[model samples]
Target: MHRLAVGINYPAWAGRNYRIQTASTVVSGLGNAAAPIATAFAVLGAGWGTAEVGYVTAARTVPLVVLMLIGGAVADRWPRHVVMVSANVFNAVSQGVLAALVLMGHPPLWTLLALSAAGGAGQAFYAPAAEGVILRAVSAEHASKALSVFKMGMNGAQIAGAALGGLLAAVADPGWVLAGDAACFAVAALMRSGLTQVGGRRESGPSLVHELRVGWREFVSRRWLWAIVVQFSLMNACVLAVETVYGPVIAEDRMGGAGAWGTAMAALSVGMVASAVLMARWQPRRILLVGNGGVFLFGLPALALALGLPLIPVVVAMFLSGVGVTVFVVGWMVALRQEIPEELLSRISAYDAFGSFALLPAGTALAGPAADLLGRSGALWACALTCLGLAAAVLLVPEVRQLERKVPEARGNLPQPEPATSG
Candidate 1:
């Protein structure tokens, strides 16, 4: 096995970016880990009904859909480092407020919704800026490998944070987990403050609406890009529906309970970490082909659960599915980074995010009802079938398959990218 050296002399900026990225990954992972437990406690421990929980979760998506593009625009207009730092700081404050509320035994549904909205807004701003900074940090030739490294760090943090959150939720107060999540954000903000902005100042942009239009155009121009987006949207809808509701329901019935679900999730995370490490060493050229092909296996866990497979078989399926997701994510990021211009990269990235995530809430909302009507097993099977179909659909695009033919150059004379206006 050949070890690929990062190659470039470690820039002072790279160190700062690496620290910031790592801290941010940890913080984001903590928040993600806390969310499920927090939401569960809000419903179970604090006496909030499922309807209220549904409302809060649904509300979070509104801001994500409405403000994500704006967040990208802000990242493009301001220094990426500044935007990221500010966003993290805001996130920390929001999480702190939520923790205080929960600890006080006054977890109002409205208050929870508001705090979640604030956090979503912060993410809208932070994600695009962070992605833009990553583009500037590494040379183009190393972009694919760099993305793989980033995924490894991000997924590794998610695994650790989620596992820690589960442990804390089991043994300690849920408020403690929320507080820890807040602390992670504070550290992320501090680390981000040290990063130097790359590529100098951005051009003053046209009206936000105009910039948004440009981003949309860039997004839709590529057949392969939109095809994957369509596939992912459908896939996400199916997966979200099953994973959010039916998977746990099935686990409770067939396995033990939430603990079993957590174990399966942890297994998935381990697989993701392994996949990221593997890709960092061996970047496939036809990323879309490789990614989508791998994604065909993503439905296995749901299928295994739907079929009432033994616990070990289900766990193994979950791990394999996690590997598929990692491959798909890394491949997608590399393709986007290589093809898109730096200026518009953040906005375009936001657009991609928006498109990919658009259906998630719908999926969540429908999952419970769908399970009620179709049965948990039926819903899980549906998700598996959808994933397989989507993967097959992505293979129809020639661009996705041919992307490997174009070896990425170190730096190209491509036109400066336009900033994203809408999220």
Candidate 2:
């Protein structure tokens, strides 16, 4: 494996699926940008407080945690591209309707809650299917590049989306942001239409429980995988919960509000974009260790927020943290694509999502109460420290610290990747 190939040029052979993925990513990025603003819009529009914010966040996420395995199973059993296209279609309709309602008048709490859950349902299927597609979309040798291209598209799109979302929220109506999200989803669906079907294997058993049992076997077999996932579970509970639900409220009260927060988010994306470029060329020797260590960066902004630091410091923290996020993501994908069996990939990924995300709602639900009990600043500090500690603790696992990348040899069971076609 020549490391130099990573940095020099885009692999022209990466194929039509890669092109479709990037195109779909553009719209997905746009929607990601708008989604947060839309949530902010809902909270502000309803004159809701911290608890409301947490609940709205949970409404979308809880379903993803619950349904992710089934989603993964669908991806593994059905044509991966079909699953992706369907999920995107669901997102378009759900957001489009929500936007219309928001445009007419202030939407009720129940409406926002329902719409968020609808969004979650789309994600439940889309996330794993989207990933599994890559296994067939590009070859094992090009895995890093394929993922880099995909992630690069996402970050670049999100940056533009976040900027636009903030502007729409502040200058215009957030309903427009929601409308924009619907349009993005529509475009993503169209882009995904071109993707070839992948994941030909059907579960050997008919029962859903049997399918889950097989998936769980793959998930737990890799100690390193589960170890890192456990760390993220805790991190999401503490760091993510505080950052998503509580941090925004703090920004509104202390900083310049939505616009300021948007800029901060963009700073994060900027870092992510830079890291993606670097990752395209660079493969680490100890990927799991690197990934595990990179999570410390997430604590930076949280600590800054807790301390009531200036906006610039928080923005900088977010920016640096974004780089860490990109590292972990790329490394995780590389490790999984190289190490896991294709027949089991989607289901394993789903299980990973399930464990990693299972506690998110609990964390979100707890964040507000934790704040009430500990004070906002105190809760933020606690969450930040807790996550930082977990990040470090994961490194103590020998499997994670020592796992090295293996150049893949021809393996049985999984179908071979087709020659990467020109776009």
Candidate 3:
């Protein structure tokens, strides 16, 4: 009776599977945070330069983008948790090999690129499979809070991981850091391996191509869904460019160098964590409207940079934007779980991710050129205004504006929680 009451009253975090999934996410988050820092240092230490770094980055991203649809189909055909574990295992192997080669000294640039691509391919599969795992683990009543708490855990891990990765890279061989990343993935794989089958595997069908076609049909069927995705495709491209490329250059010219930029990023992370905590407790009526409303804040930091605001004000902008973006992310995940059919969820999510990510490379590549052509302030101003415009325009979609929270009703068909088989 007590256990049942506890299950009824508490959020999804009460379930053993959700707890395990959260643990895996935190551990993987730490690895993800550390891997980039370590990878960059390892490249430089091996006599490679920035061009080689770009090649390695592109190598990883290309496979991830190319393979996402196939990954989604593969996840649907099997138990999603199993796919997640397999993907992590593949990543652990690739990272472990990279670590070994780096430690051996002066590893060829080609090897690094290959291993990185392998890891990215693994991630492509892992990502889509991951979308359904949490939703499957818990009841609808607790899903919103569960996702918020999950994001909080991931953000917190990233903060700790960044600090730890920097320290480890500065004081020790970056090979060791890469090794630690491999270990983190291995551990996460083990944790995820414990999840038992829920609602069974999605029925295997024709070819993966067929599955993708079906997924695309589902994706384009919803006006609200596709509209927001299209908006984000453009918005994320420009916003990320500002954050990664323009902001640093501007900081160097005006505010303090890397440290000032780092502080602002830290502020953003803190805001994300804080807002995740808030969303876990507060249930809003019009989830999409409330979530989309927060997106206006996305352009604030860019606007501040354009206006030559000092570090304090820029940091404040960054923090607020972080909070706003996180609110949308948590809300978006809730919407996906509630509104999407169980079988189609992972595939549609893959489309959503693909849309959001498709333009990112172009944006990053163009940021420096845009600044050179338009002048620094001009570029910043353009990105900020474009982001704001996209956010506003997305809200004009009637479905997005009118959709209300229907978690309970939408999730009535979800599978009931089964007894835990793995901890």
Candidate 4:
């Protein structure tokens, strides 16, 4: 009876952060499920051409690139929980607005685009604050484990969200699904309100631009960090182009329709969740090498599609790609947590986000025309070759191999000392 009680009441670990992590996972899962279905509905109901849909999706990147540094600085200067809650509120409003617009008979494309941009701006702020909270919540020794748990939660949420979104879309009006998404954001905001003050106090004196420059300097000094960013920038561009445009087009052509595309996407999410769970249990020693190596595995999906594999096999390939992506993402987060200073972590993270995602819009916008010229299968093969090349190039850098050893604090929840040298 005592043992049963202990199992129910006491977690295996100590820290409010773990509880916060769990809350985050729930919120993320609910929100993500709503987002994709809303997006799917917008595409199907609004009579938005492929190019217009791409444009709306791509426009979100603009704010991330432009205001992300400012958002990071705000996170550094304010209580991270406050920032997070506020951002969630903003996201909730945006989703609510989108739902209303859609229910009111599909508003103009420009209006939908504007709302997406507004939500993107909110997300730019939310991401850095969330990272700051994670950094502060757990002890240094537990950083890797904490990050692993966080990644697992996020991927799990995405998987659930995708599945839910698909199911919801199949049954009822998409506006209702979007409304539910807005509710999830509201709940997330409420949950964040319960968190303890995370950022201690605000820093004094420096202008936002000056702070941003300092962050840029810190970001550029790390060879492994920046190298991975560059590699992913290219990788994201390729993957987004294919997934957003070509993959759906192909699925529509071969497998019958959007439902099949949703299944493939859900498969990818499942793979990611599986990968994150594995990494959480078995933290890798050689972080950079392992991360990049896994990223290279994304090529399999592109190759499979290009080779005209059957639906089942193609789904398997997508799942494999998801696994690789999850590993790479968690590994990179672990590396970042180890390498960067907590004080500047948000700002640096913002820079990384901005730089890595900047090209996504261009990739999506160009994919249609490129597919037209090269053919869908041919374009996918090109993406596969490019990803493979980028992975190989990243492997050649000595810094990627050496940084793992240099980061001694990556294994457990111990408090980290001040960094002696910038990465």
Candidate 5:
């Protein structure tokens, strides 16, 4: 009876955080599902080839990267919940239009790509605000546990969403799947309707440039932070680049198409679920070093794809790679929160987000062409080798290799400007 009650006790479990946490997980999970299907819709239905798929995806990433700084600044300046709600609404509208077109008939490649760019713009604004909102929802002491749970929900959603996306694309229609995704964003926004504003307070700064400069200074001051960012940037550019752009297109030709790729994606999400559950309960020392080291495994899935391995073996590689991504997610968030002041958290997070995905657009742009020129296997070999080697090289940096988290005495002291009261 006691365990059952605890399981069902939404009120006392995590206080005001329950609502926002649920919403965030939905947002992340649905967003993940939508992105890949959106790509497939452009490729399979709209008749975009691999190169066009890469370019269309890059169209979304370009605006996201360009506008992240402004988004972070806005997040720090306003109520995070409000910012998030606005962003989700934009996402709903953008995707809703795309879904409508896809349902009507195959939209032109340009139209699909343009709408994708709109969604990316919304993502730019949402990412920092959502991070800030979730960060403040839970008590500081339970940060890792809360984030882990949040990630677990996202992974769970990914399992369902990715598989569903593939199944729909294979059987029904990707447009129908996209429509569901838009509805999810709407539902997510509704869920966040009551989340108390936690971002009203802002550090006293003269101007946006001044604030950004401050964020930049704070970012560079932490050698460990910058080192990890540098590591991920290279990894994304060289290896993840190949995986994201090339993997799907190749699967369409070599494997069974969207459904097989989706199953593989679901397998990856299953691995992430394991990672989230473990990280939620265990906060490790030297997380930065340990996490970064684990990323060496992340390149394996693409390597398997490159090697022309069987589906089962490729799925296994993806599973390990998923685990590696979660390790980085946990380590990076916890370490950054522990080290950086709350007021500047969003901005700093933005910088990290920018850096982590900094080269993604460039990589996406080049990946298709590179694969065409070098052969998919040759490109895969180059990417896999470069990522694994560079990630290992980051350990040579003393700051990243030796960093440890020291818990703050008052961890949950960040402002909730609206003084929220749980009913």
Candidate 6:
């Protein structure tokens, strides 16, 4: 593959497994980006409202949160790539069936919820296993660069997916968009199946309970890690509530509906892609301290929506928020892969995901009711404020404020990217 001229050096040592992992991520991200938007609009198109949309989306997350630990243990016990492939296959089947149902007719709300829950079950297994794949494939020294490239590819896919999903849903039926997502999942599964030499060596025959207990210990051992995870629990809850439920409601009522929402989401993905490219070359000394600053931006779009801002401003806010989220994620992943032992990485990651997502289902479920009680704008305001507050509070921990980069730029075999010079 040809490199970009942006001075972001793709890791030379990111060989077969890493390449396959990145390919699968990029392919899957296309579907992942579009699926929620299509799902929401599909429900609305079915003559259902925010409550039904919330219930269906929340159904997906409930299984993911509930089975996260088990999924982590399974990943650790088996080959990570195998686990990922299996999960993708399951997701493809679930999503394909949902798409078919929608195409056939309106499809009952119960079917939508059930199929969504099934897809969530696949994701519960896929996430932690997939997290370990690229890190395991690349050397520790090159992990950051590899992750940056991986994220950039994923973000790029989302940029296309969001843009197309919105336009397609607006013109054609949302069912067609859902069908495309199912196809993406199928393609991703095929790509992932080729990955070898992914995941770390593990001891055989440990009980799932025993594995989870060990993971919990590693998770809580780091004060900064757990604190940040707690912060994201609230932060993510708010994000999900808005993205899956309230944001669409706002877009439908005021903005131009699916197309407008999709455009904003596409802008967000473009911001993430830009940030990932920047992160590949820029290494900040105080990783978390600088990274967490981006968290403040994460609340902007929600705040804008809550205030009934116009589409243009909301799209701009989404873009800024995307940049912030990408910075935080790249920094967080580097820290985890650097500090945590490879053997325990998947489980610890599982714990991290579990904590971060613990409240997400409730957030989605309550979003509709919250809108009713607090008023739509009032609920959005609450979510936005809670996200900003949690981000600020997490910074109070000294470890989070003082954490430094584990590997210096000069030390890594991958050379620092050269700056472009003007002629």
Q: Return the top candidate by TM-score.
A: 6
Q: How should the candidates be ordered by lDDT, best one leading?
A: 6, 2, 3, 5, 4, 1
How close is every model to the real structure, measured as TM-score? 0.86, 0.91, 0.84, 0.89, 0.91, 0.93
lDDT per residue (tens digit) for residues 36-67 in model 1: 64545444456654334445565666677678
Please name the candidate that would achieve the greatest lDDT relative to the true structure.
6
Mark the regions of model 6 whose C-alpha exceeds 4 Å error after superposition: 1-11, 200-204, 410-423
What's the lDDT for residue 191 in model 2? 81
Q: Write the per-residue lDDT of candidate 2 for residues 59-96, one digit (tens) a residue.
A: 88889898999999888887888898899999999989
RMSD of each: 7.4, 6.0, 4.9, 6.1, 4.7, 5.1
In candidate 3, how many Å is residue 274 off? 0.4
The digit string of per-residue lDDT tens for model 3 on 169-283 reads 6567778888999999999999998887743564554788898999999999999899998999889878867765666556556775444665676677678899999988777
Q: Is candidate 1 or candidate 5 better by lDDT?
A: 5
lDDT of 4 by residue, 249-322 (tens): 67656775556666777788778878877876666688878877788778877888889887788789889998
Alpha carbon deviation, residue 181, candidate 1 (Å): 1.1
Candidate 3 accuracy as lDDT: 0.79
Q: What is the C-alpha lDDT of each candidate?
A: 0.73, 0.80, 0.79, 0.75, 0.77, 0.87
Model 2 compared with the native: what TM-score? 0.91
Cα deviation of 11, candidate 1, in Å: 9.5
Arrange candidates by TM-score, highest first: which order?
Answer: 6, 2, 5, 4, 1, 3
